[model samples]
Target: MKKTRYYPFERNRYFYGKLLTVRDFESEQKYFNDKRRLMNRLLHGTGVITGLQVIAVDDKSVSVEMGAAIDALGREIIIPSPVTLKLSMMQGFSNNEYAKNVYLCLAYDEKGKEPVHSVANAAVRSDEISEYNRMLESYKLFIREEAPDPSVFPIESIIEQTSVLYQDGHIRILQRTPRYVNPGQLFDVTFVIEKTLQAAKISFEFELVGQQLQAEHDAKVTFNEPQERQETEYEVTVKLRADSSSRGKATVGIRQDHAVLRIGDKQVSLSSARANEVMIMAGAVDKQWVDDFVNRSLEDSLDSPSDPCIYLARISLLQMGPTYMIEKVDQVPFNEYVYNASALHKLKSKDSSAPATPFSGSITARSSLRKIAGNQEPELNVTFNKDKGELNFDLGLPEVQSGDQVRTGVVEIPIASLNKFAASPFGRGGKSYVSAEIEHGLGRGSLFIYTGIEEINEDYISDILSSSERLYSGSTDVFKGSEHEPSGPDVKIGTVLYPQKGTFRIGVRLQQPTEATQINIRWWAFKKATESGAGSDDTVDISSLEAASGREEQA
Candidate 1:
C-alpha cells in the first residue's frame, strides 16, 4: 500500500489564485481544472443550476427559481436560496468562456455553508475584477434578449384562473318517471333545471292518439325563486282513460310550449321546447284464446280431407277479426262422442270334430238428435227402418210451461239405431255415414255421424261384443266357451277362432244453446272369428301355375 497524500483544503474546499511563474502555473492550472470539473459534476448531478432562471442579479445576491433534484441515494437536495458570489474571486477567467458558464454554479455553492469557493482570503485583483463585472453585464443583456415577452406569460396565467368560472342556467328533462303505464293509471313526469327563475312558468301538453281513441290535455306550473345556483326538479301527474274504446297501443307525448320568466318587473319569454313520444298500452284481450283458435283453424285447413266449414270459418274470422264473437263463446267447451257397430255370424260345427264354417256379416249406420232441455221434454219423431237402412229424427218445438224462461229442446237418436243401420249391406266393409239437419227456435243444430268401425266375421264365431260399451263403460266381453282356449299357433292354422270388437260414435253439436244441455250417443259391436279355410302358403310352383290361366287355356 502506498501512502495517501491529501491536500489541506482539498475536501469541500475551493480556491482563487493567480499564476505567478511558469513553474507555479502547472499546479495552479491543475487546481483550477479539478475545481471546475468538481463544480460541473455537482451542478449536473444535483441539478442545482441546470434550469436556473435569473430573476434579478446584483453585487450582493442573485434571485432564481429552480426545482430540487435527487442525489445518488434518491434523497432530495434543494438549491440554497439567495445564491451569492464575491466578485473579486473570479479574476483573469475568460469573459466569453468559463466565467459566464460557471457564474450560476459558483453562486449556488457560495450560498451553501460548504466551503466551495477557492480564495478564502486571497487579496483581490482590481483589473481582473473589472473584467468579471463586464462579463456579468454581458450575461444580463443576453438573458434579456433571449427571454420571451412578459405579455405572453399573462395569457396562460389568465386561462387557468378563468377555467373555474360558474356555469350559466340550463334546463333538462330528468326522467319520464313511468315510461310504461296502463289505462286509467297515473304516471309522473319530472323536469330539472340548474337554477331557479322568478315567476318561471312551465307549460306542458299531453296528447293520446290511437286507432280507437284520441284525446289531449294541458297543464302549467309557476316557480317562485330567490335565484340560487342549485338543482331544481318539478313533477307532473297525468292519467289515462278507463274504457274498452282505449284498447290498443296509443301514442302519448308531452308537447313543449314557450315558458315565461319574470325578472323583477320585466317579462322574458324562453322556449322550453321538448317533443318526445311515449307508448302506452290500454284495455285487455284474450290473447291465449285467439292464438289457440288460430292454430286450430290453420291445422283444420291443412287436414288431409279438409272440412269446408272449418276453412270458410277461418277465412271469415280473419276478415272479421279474431275478436269478433270470440268473447261470447271463449269459455264454452264443445261436445263430441263416438259410436261403433259390428256384426258377428255364428257357424255350426258338425259333431265337434270338423271346424266351424265361416259366415257372412253386415253393418249399417245413421245419426240423429238425442235430447232438448234438462227437465222439459220435447216431442221427438224418430224413425229407424232396418230394411230400408234409413234413420231419421225430427225435433218439434216444446210446449212452454209456466216457469220456462226460453223454448229449448234436444233431439237425439239411439245408438242401437246406428248399429242396425251399420249391420245393413250399405254400411258394411266401408266408411259410410249420414248427417241430419235440425231447426230449433233458439239455435241451429246439425247431427254428425262419426263412424268408428264396420266389420264382418269371415271366420268361426268366438264371441259377440259392443266396442263403445267396452271403451266408455269399461265392460269386457265374455265368451260362453272355455277361457283357456288357445287362439292359434304361431304358424298359420287351418282354423283360428277369435273375437274382434269395434266402435262407432255419433256426435250432435248445438250452437247458441238457451240452457245447459248435453247430447250423448254411442254404439259398439263385435265380430266373432269363423274358420274360413286353411291358411295356405302364398308361394306356388312356377312350373304348375300359369300367370294367366284363363287366357292360357285359350292359347
Candidate 2:
C-alpha cells in the first residue's frame, strides 16, 4: 500500500519498456516459417537429373552408374552406386520421414532413363548441377570400358559338360563283415579308393559315433602306387567296447587322413579327402536267462547259512543270419559258453556266487511204532557244505507201539540233489519223482512230500499231513522188523513232484510203524526209462561220500 509504488516488474520492463518487442515476435515467426518451407521442399520436391547409364548386366548380377546429389544443407554430395542401388531395392520408403526426404531428392526423370538428382536448386546457392554433369561424363566412360558382351549363350551345350567338369575322386565304404556283432567282439570294415589322381600312403581313423558307443581306432597301410584305372581295397579292424547299454545299430565313420604320395623328391599331398560311414548293430542281452539267474541267485542267497555262493553261469552266443525251422537245436554244454557278469550284477547285486559244485547228498531213513502217541511227529536234521559240495540228512520217525499194527519210515533228501535230478531228465518242464525202498515195516503206511518255491514251513507241513490228498501221496507195504525184501509190494512207492528250477522240499510219511525200518531214497529225474529199466539212479558210493565229507571238513 505504500502508495502502491512497487518497482516495475521484470516482465513489464521487457514487454512494455523495450520498444523492439513487436519486431522480435515478427522475426521469430519468420524463422519458423522458413524452417517449415525447407522441410516441405525436402519431402515433396522433384530434383534435377544430369545423366543415367547402365554399366553391365548378367544372369547373376546387374551394375549401374550414377552422379552426385545436393543434400538438405545445400551441399554437393557424391552418392555411391551401390548405396543408390540398395536404396532403390529397399521397401517401406514412403512411410519413413527421413527416407521419404531422400526419395524426393533422388527423383528420376519422366522417361526413367536419367539418374535422380539433387533437391537443392540455384536459389539455395548449390552448384551440384555442374558437378553432377562432370561426374556423369566420367561414369559413362567407365561403363563403356566395363560393358558385358552381347553374344547369346547355348545353354544346352553348357549343361552337357557340367557333370564331367565337376567329376572328382572320392573314398567309399565297400563292405562291413559280420554286420551284426556281439558287444565284446571286434568289427571289421572295408573301404575302397576310387578314381584317385595319385598313389598315396593312406591312414584310416575309425570311430563309432553315437550316444551309447564312442569308440575310436586308427590304422595305417601302404598302397602300392595305384595303376591308372585300378581301384584298391583297404581293410581296418576296430575293437568295439563291451557294453550292454549299447544295443541296436551304431553309426561307424571311417576318415581318410595323412595321405601323401612321393614322386622322386617331391611329396604330393592328397586333397578332397572324405569319410565313409557304415552301421553296425550290437547284440542284445537275453532277458530270459537274466531273469532266471536273478531269481535263483536271490533264493540261494536267502537259503545260505554263511556267505552267499557265486555260481558261474554260461550264456550261449546267438547265431546270425536266417534260422531254418528244420534246423536241429544244438544242446551245448554249459561250461562252453561265456557269461556277462556286469549285466547280471547290474540287475541285482554282486553278493551272489556261482553254482560250481555237483549236487550230492546221503539220506538216512529210520522208523519205529513203539513210541507214545504224543511222539508221533518225525524229526529231521540237514547239513550242507557248499564249498566242498557235500550234503547229509538224518530223518527219524516215532517208535512203534505194541499191537498198534502200523508201518512207518522216514526218507531224507537234499534239495540241491533233487534240483539237479529234476532239471536233467524232466527237462525243467516235466514232473520229477522220488523212489525209495523200504527194508522193514508193518501194515500199510501213507507217504507225503512238499515242493514249493520257498522252504517248507511247519504250518505247511502240518497242513499236508492233515489233508487226505497230500501235496504228494503214495502207499508202502508193512514188513516184519527183520524182513528185508529186494523188490516187492513192501518196497517204497515213487512219489511225483514238481521241482522249480531244480529246487523243492521233500517229505515222507509212513502210516504204520516198525522198530527195524530202513528206507533207501533216490531221485528219478527223467520221464524216460533208462537202460537199467529204472529212472537214472542218483546214488553215490559210500567211500566217495566219506572222501567228500573229509574234503568238506578240510575246506
Candidate 3:
C-alpha cells in the first residue's frame, strides 16, 4: 500500500536533515569529477599506458625511465602506445621508424668526415636500452617476488593462466603458468610461493626448452573419507636466471587431526584435506557386530507407544528419520476453539458436513510422513490430485449411537475411537482421510457417503526446514501469512483454528443431535518428487490420503 525510497549516498554525506543536489556543484568541481572518471577508465581499460615504467627495482626506489623520443629541437616528446601491443611494436611506433633510418645513415656516416646524418644512432641505442630495461622489470615481477617500486617503475604483472585436471577418481588439480620476460641484467633470480594443504602430497619440477622455460607440479589426493575439520599447508619454490635456466620444488604437509569418512552407508571418523577426493585404504570387515547393533535398536521399538499416534510417529520415523527419542512429547501451544460464526463464513468445502453451529470448521491440513512408512501406514496409499485448487475428501464414518458426536480438534484423533476402530497406522500430525462412505451397522441403514481429503482455511501452511541431522531429518511447524511467519501456537479443540499441515477435523453435529454413535475414519499418505530448480534438491513428497489401520507398539 505504501513505498519508501533509500538513497545510496545518504549514509556517508551525513547531511541527513538537509537535501543536497549534485547539480548545485561549481563548474570546476564537476570538471574535476568528469576528468577523474575519464582517466580511471583509460588507465583501467585493456593495455592503456600509464606513462610510467620500471627498469629495475630494489628494496628502495626502482630504476626509472620514460620511454619517449627526442624531437628536432632536442625536446623529449612522449607518445602513447597501448601496452597491450608487443614491446617491439611499441618501440617502433614510439621511435617513429627513426632507428631504421639511422641504421642506413650509419653506413654512410662511417666513411665521411662531416656526414649528413638523417637520424642519430645514439637515439636508437638509447631506445633499445630502454626497451631492454622494460623487459627486465617485467620478468622480475612475473617470475620472482621482487616488486619494482611503483613510484618509479611501471610494469604490469604478467597474467597467470590456469588449467584443470578432472580424472583418476574425482581429482580437480589446477596448474597456473605465469608469463614473464627474461631481464638480461639479472644473472639469476629465485621465487617462492606459499600454499596450504591437508593430509595430501604435492611436488614440483621445471623444464627448459631453448629460450623458453616452464615449471610444473603434481598433486595426488585421496578422499576415501571426509576431510578433517581443519586446515593444511604446502609451499612452492622456483629458481631462475637470465641465462634461460630454471628450477622448482614443491613441499606438502598432511594433517590427520580430524578426518571423517562417510561413503555410501558407512560412516567413519578420519582426518584429511578438503581438497583431496581420492583414497586408498585396507579391507572390509564383514561381521555380525554391525548387524547385531542395528537389530538391537529395532528390537525395542515396541517399548515406545502402541497407539495409532505412535504408529503414525513410527511410520514418520521410518519415512523420515533419525528418529529422535524424547522423554515426553512436547505439545505446541494452540488455543482451544469455541464456535465462531463470523470466521466460519470462509469455509467453502463442498464435502464438509452441514454446519450445525452457524459456523464452518473446515481448516485445511497438509500431513507430512516419511515415504519409507508408506507400506505400514494405510494413509500413504490413497491418491488425490491437486487440480483447480480444490480438495476432494472421502469421509467414511462408522456406525454410532443415535446420540454419538465426534469431538474435534487439531491433529487430535479421538483416543477411544482410535482404540476401537483405528485400522490405519497414524503418526503425530498424521492425517485421517474420512471418505464420504456411510456406515451400516446393526439396526442401522446405509447413508449417503463421500470420503478422502478435505480443505479448510488457506491461512495455515506447514514449514519443514532443514534440520541439523541427515537431509531427511526436518521438523514440521505451522505458520500463517505468506508462509514466512514463525509458528506461534497450535490449534486447540472445539476452537475454529488453522493447522500448518495435517488432516482437517470438523465436528458433525447431527440435526437430531445425538452423542451415542461411532464414526470410523481412515487416511493414507502420498508423495511426489520436486522438479529441478535452483536452491532445491529434488525428492519432495506431498502427503496423500488412504484407509488402512496399522499399530505401533511400545517397548
Candidate 4:
C-alpha cells in the first residue's frame, strides 16, 4: 500500500523518496523553485565540521575553530567568514501557522527562514527594543583561514560536539535537533555538557520515539557505556554533579555527529483524530393547532377534506447544545408523551409551511430541589392546546437558574406509545403526551424537556416488567389448561398479557430489586442471530408461545 503523507496546508511532495528542503531564506523561495542549484549547494556549498574546539571566550567574542568542506577545485579549504547566527528565544508571530513554519525551517534547515516582523517591533516599551538590538549585535564571527593541509588542525578530528562542565563532579552533555527533519536537510542542534569528564571514544545513539516508528524496519541502537557514550534524538542530555565542574567551558560539535533521520515505515494519515458525541432535546408538537389551521376560513384548500394517505413528516429540531436529553416528564409517562405529543404532532405538521403547533412542552426542574442536590421530584405537564402548549407548575420552592449543574432524570417515551394512542378509540391517533412547564415565583427559571421515541419505549418496557402491583381487573378466563405443566386460564381478572388491542395507563416508581425475582407477564421483542448470536430484530411478538430454551417464565 502507498503511504499517505499529510501537510495541513501544503501538498506533500516526494522526491527520490525523501522530503526536499527549502534552502534559501534570502529570497524566501521553496524547494520546487530550483532543484538542481539546491542539489549543487548540497554537494559542494554544504560543509560539516569534523571537529570543534572552543579556543577562548572574551566579553564580546567567542573564538572557535572548525573543519571545512572541500571546494569545487578538488582542494580542501578552510572557510573564514562570519557565521550569521539568529537566536530566536521567543519570536512573535501573527498565529501558530507562521510560528510553525519558522520553527520547522529554523530547526531542520541549514539556512533557516527569517522572521517577517521582529520581536522588537512588537515591543511595548523602550527597554524591550534596546535589549533586542543588543542581542542582535552579538552575532559570532566565523573566520576561514587557508591552511596548507586539513591534518594540520588538531580540532579537525573532534566534530562540533558541545561539552558542558558543571560545578560538581557530574557532567551533562546535551544535543538538540528538530523533532522532524527531511533528508538532505541539515539538522542544527545544541549540545551542552554539564561538567568536565574525561573520555577517549564517545558515541551517541538516536531514533524516533512512539508508534511513529514501525518495528519491522527500525534500526537498532548499540550503546558503548564503557566508552562514555550516551544518546538522545536530535538532542542528548547527560546529567552531571556539583563539585569541581567545568560545564561553562564545554564546547559543542554541531556537524559531524549528524546522521540521516530515518523511519522504519512511511506513516499514513489518520481518518480523524477525535470523535464527538451529540445530544438533542425537543418540545412536544401540537396537533390541535394544525387542525385549526386546516379549519381556517381564509384558505379552504388548507383544510384536509380527508385524512392524508401517507404522512411524510419533516420535523425541525430545537436544541441548545449538540445533544439534548429529556430530563423530566410530568404526570404522563414517556409512552404517553410520544403517543400524545410527538407522533400526532408530526402527522399534523408534515409540511414546512404548516403553522406552529398550539401545544409544546419544555423541561424544567422542581423548585423545591436545589440544583446539583438529589432528593427532588421533577415534574412535567402539557397544558397547551390548539392556542397554547404549556403547563406551569411550581414545587413551591425557591427559584433556580440555568447552568446549575443539576442532575435530572432522562424521560424516555416510546414509539409504541404512538401506537397505543392510535389504538385508543377516543384518540384520533393524534398526539397523546403531556407537557409540563415549571414556573417559579422568585429565584428559579423554566426549561423545556421532551421525550424521544427511544426513551419512551425503554421506559415503557421497564415499567411493564417491573410493575409489582396489579392495576384494574379487566378480562375473565374462559377456559383452563392441563395441570401437568400448569397451563393458566386464557381470560381472567389480573391475568398477565401482551395487549393486542387495549389502552392501559402505566405508572413508574423506582424500587430496589432483589435476586430470584420473577414475573408472570413476559414482554420480549424479537432479535436476529449473528455469528456470535447477538443482534435484535426489534420485532414485537404478542402470543402465547413457549419460551426459548433456558428462558422460562416465572411466577
Candidate 5:
C-alpha cells in the first residue's frame, strides 16, 4: 500500500486508437475512488454518525452494533450487522509490542482477504494470469493497535472505534441537569463508571455560559460551606456505592479572591443509589444568577392584572412614599363589642414589608406621619373635660405646608404629668366628640382608635407598670435633630410606668405636600393596660393650684 500516486492529468483517455493497458485501467479507477473519498472526508468529517455502540459481551470480547460512519479518508462504512470480536484473538494484540487500544475498523480489501473467491485473480494457468481482478473491492473489518494509513502494507483504514475502556459499561451521566444555570449557583448532576476505573480520568465538565473561570482557581468543589484549600486535588470518598459503581463523594472547588467557592458534595450509595441531600453547592454558579435575578423581580407581587404596574408607576411618577402603620390599643373593649375577640387570634409578625398591610387588631393602624421640621412647632392645646372625664388634645398649624420651608413636629406629653388636674369634679355627663377633618387626606393610611380610663389604687404598680415601654417624640429637627429612638422596648410599644416618656410624633412626606393638609388621628388615651393606669412626671404650678379649705371645697 505504498502511497497511491496520481497526477491531475494521469486519468486515461480512451479513444479509437488508444492502447488499453492494465496500468491505464488502474489509474482511471484510482482517480474516481480518490475523488469520492475526498468528498466523504470533507463533507462529513470523520466519526460514527449513528448506531456504533460497543457493548461488552464478556471480559475478553465486545460486540460492535450495526452503524454507519465516515472515515478520515472519506470512506463510507456501514456495518450491516453486529460484529463481535475476541480481544485476545485480535491481530494487534499479538503483533503490536504494546497494546494500548485496538481499533476495529471497516476497510476496502482488494486482495480477496475476505471469503469470496479465496484468491486475488481467477486464472486457468499461472503463466496466463490477469493482473486485474473480476471481483469488486470487498468491505471487511480489521483490528489493529494503530489504524493503518494509505502507506501501510495493506492499509486497514477507516473511522476510529470507541475506546475499549469507555464503551457501554464505562461512563454515563445519570442525571439531567438544568440547561441554563448561573455561573456560581449550585446544581446537582450524577455520572457513573465501573468500580475499578480511576474516576478522575473521565472528564466531568460543567458549562458556564459566556464566562470562564481560571481552571483549578476560580472554579471550586465544595462538600458544604466552602473553605480555602491549598491542595490541588479535592476529593473525599463517601462510603456506600454499588458493586459496579464508580460513584462516591467528591468535591469541586475554585479559588475565590475572597474564599474558596465550592460546588456541593457528590455522594452516592448503592442502597439508595441516590446521593445524599448533600447540597451540591453551586456557589458561583448560583450566585451569579441570584445577583442578576433577585433584584430583577418585584419586591412585592400583586394579583390584579394592572396591580404591579399600578404600584410601580405611582412610585416612579408621583415619587410616592411607603405606607406606614400606627396602632393605638385600649385595655378595655367597647361596651357592645365581643369579649376577648382580638385576644383569640394572636398572629405572629413576618417582620417585613407586606404587599398590602392588613389591619391587625388588638389595635393596629397603618398610616403615614410627616417627618417634621422642629422649627415653628405646632401648639398642642390639651384640655380635660370636667363633666365627661375625657381629655381632648389639638395640635394645630394654619398652613401645614407652603413653598420651600417645612413644618413637621414631634410633641411628647406625659400621661402622669396631666394627672395634675386629678379626677374632674364633673363626672360622666355629655359625650365629647372628635370631628373627622383629614380623613380624606389619608391615601394609603389607617388609624386605630382606642380610649379608656382605668381606676388604680396607686399603691401597687403591677407587672404591667414595672415592665412596659414608655415613649417620647422622635426627632423634630429635620436637619439638626434630637434623638430618634428610645432606650428599649422593641417588641413592646407605648407601655407606661410613672411616665418616663410618652409617644407623640407627626410625620408627612415633603415631596410637594398639600397646601392645606390635615391629619385625623383617632385618639388613644393609654391610662391603662394589663389591668393598670397611667400617671407621672412634669413641673407643677403651685400658684395655679390653691389648697382647698372645708368651706372652699363646698363653694
Candidate 6:
C-alpha cells in the first residue's frame, strides 16, 4: 500500500561498537543494483539486444533461443539457454476467435525468496506473520493480443508473432530496400523481385505519399496445380499499422526463422526448404540494409536507436475446421526503404510527375558576349502578353539534380540600364550606347531572378510573374524633321532636301578673302525638308567671289 523510492548511499556508517545487521547489507546491495538499472535504461532502450530467435515448432508451439534484453525499467534479462514453449498455454490465448494473431512477448519478473526475519521457518498456520520475504529477479514469457507499446509495458520485447490461420503455404515473398542516403542527394533505382513457381501470376503496386506513409502490399498467391481442397488461392494483403515517428522513409524487418512472403503485388524469392533468416536491415552506401545483413543478425534487430520495431511478416489460413493443408514456402528480400527525396519521389504515382515549366527547359543559347552570330537574336523563349502586359522568358538552363541546388546565374534585366538607353527618334544630344554586361548573353532583356529552384523546378517562372509587368516608353520630339533650311554637325534623315525625280546640283560662290575667311554654320531649318538648300552629300558648283575693280562694276 506504500511506494518508496530508493535514495542510494544512505546506508549507516559502521562504527566499532555499532551492530551490523542484514538490513544494512540489503541496503548496500539495492544502491548498486539500482545504479546499474538506471545505466541500462539510459544506455539501451527496450528490445532484444542479441540472440532471441522464435522458431515455429508446430501449429501450437514455438522455441525461444537464448538472448539478452533491457526492460523499460532498465533491468537486464539474460536467457542462459534456449527453451521451448506452448503458445496456447501463455496468457491471452483462446480457441474462440477464427483469426487469432498473438505476439509472443518476453517479460521480466522476480522470484527467489529472502529471509523472513521476524519468524522461524516453521510457522504453524498458513497465514504466518513475517518481517519480509525479499525476492530474486527472474523473467517470464507471455503473449499479448497486440504488439506492446514501450510506454505502458516494462517489457515488450517480442520473440515472434503467430497467427492461428490455416495457410496452404504455397505463397512466399521477398523484398529489397535502398540502404544509405546520399547525405545531400538521392538517386533512382530499378526495383525488381524474382519469382519461381508453375503457372503463377503476380503484380505489385505501392504508394508512400503525404504525412501518413505506408506501403500497402496486395498479392494473390494461387495454386494452379490441382489440389484436393476447394480453395486454391488466398490474398495476402498486408496493411501496416501507421506510426507517427517515420513519415516519408519506411524501414521494415522480420525474424530469422520466418521467411516473409512480402506483402505486395504477386511476387516471391530464394527457393529452399528454409530460406535465410529475415535480417534485412537498411544501412549501405551503394545501398545499405543488404550487404551488411550477412554480418548482422535478426537477433540484434532491436539494438539500433535510429529505426523502429517494424512489421516483419504475417500469414493467412483458409477455413479453420482443419481440412486444408499448408502448401509450399517461398522467401523474398525487400527493396530498401529510402529516406532521400530522389528515391521517395519515384514511389509516387506515374501521373505525379510535375507539369511542364520553363525551369525544366534546356539552355538553347550559350552564355556569350559577342553579337549573337549573324545578328540573330537569341531565342529568349519569351512571350509577351499584350492584354496583360506580362512577359515570360525561359533562361534555358539545364535541369539540376535534387542535391545540386545552386541555380546561381540568371538572365537579369536591368530596368535602370534599359531606361538609360531608351532613345527618341531624332538625334540631337548624343548617340545611343549599350554595354555588353547588361545587353549580352542571357541578359538580352535582363528580366529575371535566380536563387536556385529550391522550391519549384522550372527554367523560368515568368508565365505567372510577367502578368503584372508593364512597358515603359521615353518622350519623343514631334518637330524633329522641320522644313526650314539649316547647317549643323549632323542632319536628320528626312531633314535633308533631296530631289524626288531627278539629280540636282548646287553652286557655292565665295570671295578670295584678303584676310583669313571664316564661315558660320547654322541649322537653317525652320523647315529644312521643304526649303531646299545646299545640302550635305550633294553635287555643287564651286566658284570664288571676285574682288570688284570699282563699286559701279559690282552693281
Candidate 3, 92-121: lDDT as tens digits: 122221111000000000112332333434
lDDT of 5 by residue, 1-555 (tens): 222222243566778988888698878887787777655533444455556565556544566677666544445556678888765564534432221223444453444322333255666765553443364443455454332221221111111111111122212222222222222222223222221121223332322111221121122222331122111122322111111222222322211222321223443222212222122222332343445433432221111111000000000000113321111111111011111224334333343454442333221211111122335665655543232222333333322222111112222222121234746422122212222122111112122223211112223444446523232333323323333333221111222221212333322222221222222222343221212212211112121121110011100
The lDDT of each candidate is: 0.27, 0.29, 0.23, 0.24, 0.30, 0.34
Please give the TM-score that candidate 4 achieves against the real structure.
Answer: 0.13
lDDT of 2 by residue, 303-410 (tens): 211211111111111122331111111121111122234655675542235443344332222211111233568665565434323343433344332321222344
RMSD of each: 46.2, 38.6, 35.5, 36.6, 36.2, 35.8
What's the lDDT of the predicted structure labeled candidate 4?
0.24
Models 1 onward score TM values of 0.17, 0.16, 0.15, 0.13, 0.27, 0.31
Segments in model 3 whose C-alpha atoms lie over 4 Å from true places: 1-31, 37-199, 204-234, 240-555
- Judge candidate 6 at residue 455 and give its lDDT: 17
Stretch of 10 with least lDDT, candidate 2: 141-150
> Which candidate wins on TM-score?
6
| Preferred candidate (lDDT higher): 2 or 5 | 5
- Please give the RMSD of candidate 5 to the true structure: 36.2
In candidate 1, how many Å is residue 358 off?
A: 68
lDDT head-to-head 1 vs 4, winner: 1
